[model samples]
Target: MSRQTNKLTATAVKSAKPTDKPVKMADGGGLYLEVRASGGKYWRMKYRFAGKEKLLAIGTYPEISLADARKAREKAKERLSEGVDPSMAKQLERKLGQQVAANTFQLVAQEWLERVHQHDVVPDHYQRNRRRLERDAFPVLGKRPLSEISAAELLACLRRIEDRGHVETAHRVKALCGQVFRYGISTGRAERDPTPDLRGALRPHRSQHFAALTEPSAVAELLRAIDGYGGQPVTIAALQIAPMVFTRPGELRQARWSDIDLDNALWSFTASKTDQPLLVPLPSQAVAILRDLYGLTGRSEYVFPGARSHKRPMSNVAIKAALDRMGFKGQMTAHGFRAMARTILAERLGYPPEYIEQQLAHAVRDSNGRAYNRTQFLEQRREMLQRWADYLDELRQAHPSSSQSSAQ
Candidate 1:
């Protein structure tokens, strides 16, 4: 027996009045429009699977036009002909869609950042990494499934960043993507990291070390210039203290009042890079500068609070700008103080490298190759810093021409 199909036209379906009960208008091949008494029109299909009749709801009228409804009906029939149940197939497609949506690259990267990355780095580092991903990677590959992103596609994203002449940033973005991909693999959201396949794809970029003055004469001149700077009072104080401590600029700016004990001349805080507790034995010179600056910023949390707000730390570039003002822009940098101290301490003052490195909070390994503990050379480092401060005092007080020969 052959059942008639296409018995309803578009006009007939639209003009068909709803009765007191629901009515079905057949279009063709198990497709029909259900006109409910409540004025709702919906498209449905009636089909047989394993000898049992079932229904599939396509969509509503107008939203699902007649041509679109016919196409959907044909696709559903194709699934049925392939020995698959169309209703179950539709449900499976929907579930897969939901799964893909849940496993998007952006979502996985965010989970990685919050659960693992944030806790591993300082807040500013975490924030900068997040911003890098947002600006560079997220807009392109964010919505795609992490496991499905090919190596070439990811490289294309990096290439766009490279094309902008930000070769270093492009490399950094690539590394960040690699981290997210590795995280995805560990969390079962991705099958593998594609970044390994991208080796040698990026343009070669020469690494540039931070500008530093290792010469004792230049360091002496730099110290003299820092003392004479006429900036904000807090900035002047920071400049005075910078060479004495020579901790990373971020660490110095973020120094808290509670971390210092003027009586003992020690500052103790966790190192941002190594995440280890560091003990800085402040010289009498550094302690004096702190004591004088305390009256102005003693109540604030940060030793070097921001200019506009006491709640936040000072701008990271404050010292760099001060150096530029002092005519030492290319000659020396704020970080140059570390190289200056390390060089003179070992080459001039004849201090052991171990003591100077330990004072610098660097990871100096023992004979067995294990990292030495924080307190390993405490007493020697204390003496070394005091002497280092005295040496700086000598340099600052020396006549300009005599500064070069004043080193011990």
Candidate 2:
């Protein structure tokens, strides 16, 4: 628009009428009220950048009044003087506004949960982290802006978890918070990961070893008790095979029909902790227990299908509940079976440590940093496991109250 063209007024902008072609009501200085052919009114600014003409939207009319449009136009002129494109400036401003809108700790944390936590970790690990965040972190810092969350505030949040004697959980949650904040920084939502500032702030967590029976006599008692356990057949079968295979309770409970090769007397599964394939050389006693169970659950996907839902595996809680009923709550956990087998395999059976580790399916890596093969000690493990089962039978027979029940 030239100086000679009359400036548009608020009344002219309000009553602007549409026509077959769009009309521009000049407000001078390259600003105009655009009346489109479809009866839409817009505020458009015409400018030149890098020798090309461009249109920038200041805002729609009625929301951006005449005074506001003039101010916006003045701001655009200043940017032009600075050799910056006004249109590019508007786009950047919108992007920054969106960044500001989504920089809240809760939103960023939720994003981290989906993109990093759940994607990288196992499902059970993700669930535990999710629950901790909901119960501990979300209540304190969820809605706050990531920029405003200080180290002190987060330490206070973690200290609350420690006060409740959840020392390890507190440490874990702190590590998770660090992961979330670092993700926010990487994604341009936060400035810093405040967790590093909290170094040595939380108390160290002491790990308690799982209580297990390493003594031959104690093992005899546990085996005898399993024989007399008045529980479901599935439960009884699981108890019977535990001493022979000594698999992690979760892995044993989640065993599937396809994972078992009864003809070859081998039970295969992927280890949950290390995410590696495992092959447990089933002894004759263990194979007998599984063969008996096949008559009950061979049609289902899970060898030990849930009582309530055959589609799913048996509940870990139910297995633990059975342990509680057998007077082994704190004295012995289901995981204790692994420790018992690990000790006796090395101490009594005199198996090589490498062979024992292989049978335990530990995450042992070779010199090339490749994981040891799943069947590395297959033959040795097959021999060792059978001897362990026979030794357990001998211990049961040596006991004072040996019922001499069949391996059926």
Q: Give the Cα lDDT of each candidate.
A: 0.88, 0.84
Once fitted onto the true fold, the runs of candidate 2 whose alpha carbons sit more than 4 angstroms away are 1-29, 35-40, 50-53, 62-68, 92-126, 129-165, 174-199, 365-371, 400-408
Write model 2 residue lDDT over 11-67, tens digit each, in one string.
888998999999989898889998899988888888888899988898887888877
- At residue 406, give the lDDT of candidate 1: 75
Clashes of 1: 0
lDDT score for candidate 2 against the true structure: 0.84
Best by lDDT: 1
Model 1 ranges with Cα > 4 A deviation: 16-19
lDDT tens per residue, model 1, 1-408: 787777777788779788999998888788999999988899999999999999998999879877888888889889888999888998999999998898899999999899999998777889999999999999999999999999999999999999999999899889999999999888888999999999999998788677888776777788888878889989988988888878877888889999999999999987778887888899999999999999999999999999999999898899899999999888777777777788888888899988888778788888999887877788888888898889889988888788887764
Give the lDDT of residue 260 in candidate 1: 95
